[model samples]
Target: MMTHPPRPLALGTALMLASQPLWAQETQELAPVLVQERRTVLPSPAAPLHTRTALPVSVAAEQSFTRADIEALRPRDIFDLMETSLGMNITRQGSRINNFSANRGGNVSFLIDGVYLTATQAQRVVGDIPVGAVESIQFIRDGSVLSILPVMGFGSRVSSPTQGVVVINTQPAPGKAAQDRAQIKASYATYDSWSTSGSFRHSWMDGRLQLGGGYQHAASQGKPDWNMAYASDTYMLHGGWKDPDFMAMASVFINKGEREIQRYIGVLPNSSVAVGQLNSATWKYDPRDTQVFTLNLARYWNGQHTTALTYGRGKADGTAWYYATNVNPDTVAGRYFKDESTDLNLSHSIVGEQNSFKVGAQRIGYVQLTETLASAKPAPREEEIYGLYFTDEYRLTPAWAIDASARMDKKHISKGGDKYGADGSTLKLSDDTWTDKAWLLSLGTAWQINPTWRLSGRYAYSRTPTPDSITTSANQELPDERLSRWELGLDAKLHPALQASFTPFYYVIKDAKVVDSSAPKIKVFNADTGSYEALSVYTSAAEVIRKGFELSLKGRFADDMLGYEVGWSHFKDDSVTADSGTVETPKNRYTARLDWRYGPWSSTLSALRVDEYCHYFQGACLPTGDFTTVNLNISRRFEHGIKVSLYGQNLTDKRYYTRHKTGNGQTVYNLSDGALADVGATYGIEIGMDF
Candidate 1:
């Protein structure tokens, strides 16, 4: 089972081996062309999107969700696999749902072709990326941000943002060594809504350089005050080149993404929070253009050491703000805003005896400028952040290896506005240069205890950045948002075709930030005074801890092509109430997904459950109980890049909220248990083609 690191068969095997317990199967190396960037530049002349088992970690995991062998049928996103893997659950309070991957989405980081694609969306912005366009996705669940993997902040924990790299090959180019393919997909849902997308790609010599483009649009219908209209478009241009001497990939997206949020909460007019909903509120993140360019240069020097230099530049310009407010039913409260950022990145990796180490640096300039009418005043600031990180991986033994790394970021508010405590107020504060620094450490061990069995585990200590408001001395440096995480687990091979893993983990968010901001200059005051200790663009200086267990199962009992997988997880956040002094966790969440394939038929089944989730507004919760849901998908495959899929979600019409109740009484947490759930079911018929 020795892998050459340059074979398609080994690629899939590597993915399977890295994710779960390895099976007893012969392995082979991939074609020379396949292992090189040149392969990606060539087309298979069979499909639109590159359909292969070999892909980098950044691509989404397709077989995990689309395979039908051991699966029933379900409709879900690629991230949904984590739901079942770790008994994870997603709660949608309003229109947006936070999609977590393996590890209950805890400590998950996202990347597209090595560029970090991390942004806190005002609301759930539907990305028009076609699932079929994905080639393969690599994941390092419960790993470290330094593990060349993704890790998200623990839930409700205040931590600075971090990112890993992701690489995607939407289409293969022409005249190259790799296969080129295009993918077109169309689907219509229950609300007379339909989504259409098309993607094209081409390549150059030996797949040294690849070019790809894609576009997607989806639209639907709704009621009067509850009108629902969502039509969005995204255009992407991506290219990559890999040679013995250099490797580079660049991508840009111009998106006019829009969404019409229905006033489903208007019925609860008693809660003025609903006031914002009835206003035909439309949120459009319309990014005129977002671009990311990455270049990697590596050469084998004397075959003993590898020298590499990586550089990246990214820019994002778009509108980022909320329009209507429940506090003010009038249109005067709504206004447009702007958000823009520019960043540069560089890294170097070196090889050593039985060990490899890498170090990198990043500089980012961010600006939040409001785009208001002539009458509007400016409340904008420009800030800069400098970050440095290093990682090391060791090959202790063929059976057991170890990985460790750390990173630090120093952020400076080169410029910002002065703060006034208010008229005769002692709380007056001035803006000072703010700096944030972080560190991360991780250890991993993978032991092939025997030929038929293997075991692995990981534990990490990581510190991310928090908001400047969290640390101040009349104006002090921002505190470092910190997280202490430890994960212990085991993988076992019951047989060759069957595998299983159980991982229980714990994480603590120290000095997590609590957001409470205000602008007293204008007579407008936040009535929630006690909670309104202070106002800031971002805030959190509290401590919160989260613990959970994750389980994964997948085996091939049928033919070799048939794939089966099932996963489940349980998560809870323990806390004590301020008044009653009772210990409780947000909720007990669970998820289950099964996928199997037989012949051309592939089906999947998924389920999600959250126990007694408390929704507090102003300081209240909706109710106590288990909120559950189910989804299913069925599809068939054919030759020449053409396939159709039938999918149904929320089969039981279980209504649930994507968000938790955070406010208090007068304007907060009083409501029916599942008032925010999407109770109705949605089904869609999809047609896909690649080549």
Candidate 2:
């Protein structure tokens, strides 16, 4: 499919208004309207003392993005935003779809509005939430900065802290009567895609109560192809009440969407890779629906001490089908999955002139059910987690500070029911219940050497529970995966307008889980039914080590009219279990952006680069090619409360393959079939207003 530019009429109108702002000015009486500014505005969450963790400089680094940055970039989705961020690796699988790894590599935790999203819901955070609903995006690369219970609650048991954490704060209700505000935004783009979003917050009862809601709808028939069509809708509602001694808040979010299932196509012998040749012509799609609700209550007994309680419930339903060729019969397999979870958390915090302390307890219950029609097996699993944590931060001198934290967690998982195969044959299940416990600790310090330079260091130990699907040693018992990390950094202010930082870190994981295709599969046969059932399994491997360094520079010139940020990273990961030399992710990545504003016109240009790597967990270890792309956004602010933008991605229209491999890596190899592909140059336009 050919790429298209933004709609001519929209582009021309926006440019005309920006160039001739005097002609568009109006002298009309205005009510109490919210004024929009062009600087990063940090979002302050409700009950910050308990909900959001205070980022300690010695423990981890923080990256924050605000509304001004979001509007300037005009991101199509979360994927777009992350793709342009520094030290992040984003691989595009399709339009508005991507897989990402931050810093070292593993699964990152996603928290919205200070409430941890369930596993099923967390997977969609990058693609489902509208930019209008976000007040700020904060990324913390160090797990030691927060309590282990929260980190583990949002992350899978099989993943570790090396994966990093992302906190997304949604727009809160207005806190003042006159500052109440509302907005509406609409955009149209290539491939017959469009979106509409709006949100508002109003305060009443003498600024003691607030209510707000937001809605977003986005749809696309990507590239006018039968295989590339999808649509989604998102809704958010929130309410808050505040008094001198007590504060309470509640929020609800709903997301429903469907998309054509995209599967990998193998490579062809001695041929070029292209989108048209990379997909199976299967007529199938996947549908999903998810909803989540959260409530928080906090009370202040004195100026220095406060207590808080929080509760959350979430549910998700999903179903999909695809044709599998690896099996003997090339069977069409359909699967259904369900997830439900509830969480309760209690915490207390005390603040003093030179010291602070926080203590919290948490409990989480989760259930997952999976049914596959092709295999005809229904497997259900339930998990419960209980944890206690405490943190202390203190300043020892004018130039030195220290902090420490400790946490303990107990986890239990139960497998339910014997699973049946397609022929009504049942396989006897293994042990029904598994229990594990672990403790984590972190210590760090920061020193200010001079007015322009500072140094920090931290050491932490954490653990990840092994899933039941993994095979144990000769004893046939599950093992808990453990991780230890050490990091050191230097932050410097070279000039009043420029800043720089360099961080180097290393971590290791014990009992790393490795997928072994050559290992024996589990098979069970019943004499009564004269049928057999088989299951796949994984084995434990030696220690896995990951080392990395991140460097960044930021500068604002010409009195803040011009701004730029550059980030570069290098990583080396090795798994002794895989027997392979290197991990499946890239070793080098870079991202940079330049922003310029003059009068009512503003623009941002960004670039990203990712090195080649193998596909992780695919058994075949397919090697992919390197990729680089550039994006640009330009917008004009009109005097009458309207702003218009024109944006384009991959302006050069480079073609790249998503998954690449010869059939076999250890033996004779040939181009495989059905490889996945990504899109080319795309463009769009947006218009928004606030009143």
- Which candidate's lDDT is highest? 2
Instruction: Put down candidate 1 lDDT per residue, 234-301, tens digits, no spaces.
Output: 67777777666555556665556555544334324455346334433333333333444545445544
Model 2 clashing-pair count? 9
lDDT by residue (tens digit), candidate 2, 401-476 = 7889988877666553354332334544454464466678899888766666778898888876665443333325
> TM-scores of all models?
0.72, 0.82
Measured by C-alpha RMSD in angstroms, how accurate is candidate 2? Answer: 11.0
* Candidate models: Cα lDDT each: 0.48, 0.66
lDDT at 337, model 1: 49
Per-residue lDDT value at 9 in model 1: 59
